[model samples]
Target: MVTNRLWRTLSAFNCSTRRWAPIPLRNTQSQVTQRLSPTSRKIDTLWTQRLSIISWNIDAFSSRPVSRAKLILSHILEGPKSPDILFLQEVTPDVRASLLDDARVRAAFLVTDAEDQTSFEDVPFATMTLLSSARFAFGLDSQKESDGIEGGENFMLGRISRVALPSKYRRDALYVDIIPPTAPGTFFRLINVHLDSLGDTLHYRTHQMEILANVLREPGCSGGVIAGDFNAISPEDDGLVNKNGLVDAWVALHGGADPDGATWGVGVERRNGLGPGRLDKIAMMGLKAKEMEVLRPGPIEVPRPGEEPVEIPWSDHCGLRCTFTI
Candidate 1:
């Protein structure tokens, strides 16, 4: 009789174990199901914040054994606000370190073939560079090298997140996919250019502008910006300034039109004021120009720190900056 009771007790214990066995698994099953579904996973993905882009074309001609470098460095560091995306023209690879390594600024993309001055000692020329916030990935588009001007390499960069280019323009424009910190599906692109100098024939300059316009109209361009020293006095200077889809930020801010903000009036008169010709400008495509300003000559520390702050008659032109809300 004791043995029979023992067996009956064992059977009851086994039955209880079976009933409770699935309790823990039942609690976790819903969680597993939610994670495995595609729609739920997408909803869980977070996005970056909206982006603020600040761009400037630092005059490249003023470098000497010491003075030019000081002038360039001072202009970059003293901006009203630190730029997340700094588009600089007349930058040489040599001076790139000075600008990038400044305790105040961060480096992103320094395009090869585009950087004209490699060092402080190198003669300054047009060095076009595109800088982005640390949050974004930027570089040259090596694949498009064929489309670039002779000896020009198509440098490219983008954010780490996924983004798409819009299809519209025909030429191979610089393709960049930007994912803002807060917005999703609002990515955009930026194209850097230094159109023919005023010294270049009108035909040449006009052709260059036409090419630029065609490139911006290409597919995968989406909403983007084209910026740099256009060298044109004003949109009306040539028959080419009419709105072909892009907006002129400088014109919008100052009214219908004004003198080119570039202080250098003529290439030869580059030292003190806007040179004889209006040689610097910033233009935008697809995006509204929020605010624009021409960074004027300020008291840059003369190459010698012990020396007093002096005006840098560095390049023939001053820098033009445009800030856009994206």
Candidate 2:
């Protein structure tokens, strides 16, 4: 059971066994078209906005300190290039609170309920989340899994549930139908996932990936994106991260794997966790891609603007942000 802030909600609509309260994160995406002039249609600010999506594992507060969470929010929202559509993994309730409290963050984006929120000590750690601006709206809140969208499923962000997992693993993936304000009928499915950790074998990861592929390839599905901490070192790991005919934006852009693209840290390396591997990722299903960037500014702690004394560590894994010019 996850009880999170509407600042962020702990929801997996299917997790009916757990009772929860929904936090009211305001989203003024729907503003009635007021007539200001004679014979004129009201203009929507988001009509021509291009989506700038991001996927990150902000290193939850359950394991890390809250100060680090604050720094993470600062880098994401305070930076010059904050995202318009963000997909996050490993978000705990405490960290979610920090994110919600950030005046800049709240002013810019509306967050969705995270998966498996409040898991440890009644607080969540390493859960999945998706947040967006007015240009992109969640079709359904996490609480409405598979319930279908009101008005029209075509217009709402439909909820998607997980397909398979090990009996011991109780984690859920973050899936939502993103309806772009500019394109009314076109919906993009976004799945933010965190697979099993290092101890889990290739077979275990492969099973999870296959199940995820099924979710992405559902009938009537137009196009989608799959991203998050994939826990993969290479494309083919005994069928791990089944790709499901999706394109890896990093691989597509760089021709091959680059050391900078690694998202997971391993071993006992103090400077960077596990020596850094491309554990985090962004990929697309049946969609065209334009830009992909691995946003790591060298080492664990990167210097932010005007914060000389503070060299904030971006995260255990660097974030992935991409632009899809569809």
Give all TM-scores, in the order shown. Answer: 0.57, 0.67
Estimate, for each residue in 126-151, the C-alpha lDDT of model 1 and write its tens digit.
33343432334332232233344432
lDDT of 2 by residue, 65-148 (tens): 456666665666667777766777777667765655555554545455433344334324555454543343333453134334
Where does candidate 2 stray beyond 4 Å? 1-49, 61-64, 114-124, 138-156, 160-164, 180-186, 234-243, 266-274, 297-314
Name the weakest run of 10 consecutive residues (lDDT summed) in model 2.
Answer: 31-40
Name the lDDT of candidate 2.
0.55
Give me the displacement of residue 271 in model 2, in angstroms. Answer: 12
Error of 1 at 205 (Å): 1.7
Most accurate candidate by lDDT: 2
CA-lDDT, candidates in order: 0.43, 0.55
